[model samples]
Target: MSAFVAEPTTALEIESIGNGTGLWLPPEVRDEVERVQSGTSAAELTAGVVELRNLIGGSADLFHAAMLALMCGTMVEHGAEPGAAIDATLDLLVATLNTLAEDPDEMARAASRLSIPAAMTMLARSKETRKRWRARPEIMDRLEALEDADLAPFWLREVFTLHDDAPLLVLDPNNRRAFEFRLIGVRDRLYHCYALLQDALLRHTGPGYLGAEPVDPLAVRYARNDHLTPADYRAATTLGDHQRFAFAYPGIAFMPGSGTPAELPTVDGVPLLTVSPKTIHFNWRPANMYGVIHEALGSSIDLIRELSPADAEALLSRCALP
Candidate 1:
């Protein structure tokens, strides 16, 4: 009998398994393309092509809803959905619409050709939310003066289709205030972390603890300790910029000027604990790094309080710093 023969797999064949198609771009490349294509300065044709590619290859329903909310001021104005995703999208739309309504420049641009009654009708019906959108008196006056016939259909469509949760008018005598209590709660937790980190760094950097704390413990226990010789202090201070680039730590989001110890002459006594979009600045002097860790632990504690004991324990265990 003749021996069976098998065809060899080429690189192209190997690449096809997870690639979805021969045309699929790698994730990193796709991300770069997305970043570039999002820019408005690109040629309309090129931008349209990129947008089409993104809609086809990198689609996310939440993202599409968000875009529609920003541009049209209402998710339902575009289309509708059901279930948890719909609810979440509506919430996001409300948030974004609220932001736009609050901004005078943006509101002006959006309502330039819209009439008050039409706008109010849109607000009332969209999202079925009844919150009033209030603006500065001057903007309101301008909106009130516009005639219905002069209004633009697109502008009216965008305005009326916003989520019901949007803040439309403070003119209503019975309007309730909308505040994000959760953000306040989070801020309190963050402040507690800062204080704990500050205290821990102060204690660890003192001469007594430095003499007795083992090197590993000293490093971990006093990871953020910034008190050192003048030369060492400078060196440690320099690490602030580099620490922002560290990938191992993901829980903390650093703000450029936030994490720095506030008392420095250069910083005008502001703490170096700024929160930025991508990073949290640990700008505290090296002597204060331990303090920051303590602060982080405190913040973690606050967060854990919101979870079940089992989940909290798991999170704490995972947060153990090396």
Candidate 2:
């Protein structure tokens, strides 16, 4: 229901596979990787349901080897530097593959199909790699110009105050510029990947129970004068709250051999999006990436423009998580 944009989820491609260097992928693994990398978006993974089953039932060594090969190849193709950037990416790939290897179908149903916390942590590490790049005076000038141009709408507002009122994870205005850009990139990547994974689950399982890994719930609060009843509070914490609600259209029906009967339907309470975190409460869908970001990072672009590259870098260095 939220408006958002997304990029394609690019699958990593491996050129060679082996236990050691100069090794080549076995015939079966090579075919699978090639088929997957060619055009199959992760969202379209359902199309490969047969292939997934085959891989799962096949030799574990072959599957792991193929995945590692793809990852290593993708790294080489991108010419990714051998530091934190490449390392973090490989780690995520490893974790994803390992989870899949353990139980392909179960994990396939998971929201994000990997880990959100790990992604945030890796995002912080990736930001660190850009420290020197953000310190450049030209980049700082660019940051200032961006604030003046793209963020003109927010120029009159106080940066921190605005951020405090919003759900976005934003850098302090005094932080470095590169970190903000990296954060944006990482956010986009996370959203796209998760969407692909969620889509895959939907396609494979249809409109049934698609279980998700638990995540932090967005704290939705009501304001004064917004009437709240005990039922509303109870419903908010219960699984029943996941149901979508809307105003009913009034209508009347004529009764046979009798006068017209007026139908009055009484609707109770206001509609709100709610979710219970962890199994202690109830089973409900996790918030989609767009919803999470929409709640957390509203007007984040405007806020980022206020930050100097130096200030952004410093802020990132101090944070353990994004």
For candidate 2, the TM-score is: 0.20
For 1-322, candidate 1 gives per-residue lDDT tens digits of 0010022223442344235453234467456545533534324323433333233212232222233222222221223211212323334433333434455343232322122222232243333232233233433333333323332222323232122221111000011111111110011122223333333332423433212222232232233232334454455444322222211122443323233222211112211222112233343433332223211111111111123445434433444321
How close to the true structure is residue 310 of candidate 2, measured as C-alpha lDDT? 62
Backbone clashes, candidate 1: 49
Candidate 1 at residue 279, lDDT? 33
The digit string of per-residue lDDT tens for model 2 on 1-322 reads: 0000011111121122111233244467566555644533433332332232233223233223233333333333333222323333334434443444345442221311222222222222243333323324432333344345432122111111111111122222222222111122222222222222223323332443224432222212211102434553454453111211111111311111111112212222211111111133222322322222211122212122324556545544544213
Q: Candidate 1 at residue 162, lDDT?
A: 21
lDDT of 2 at 114: 23
Q: Tell me the whole-model lDDT of each prediction, alpha carbons only.
A: 0.28, 0.27
Candidate that scores best on lDDT: 1
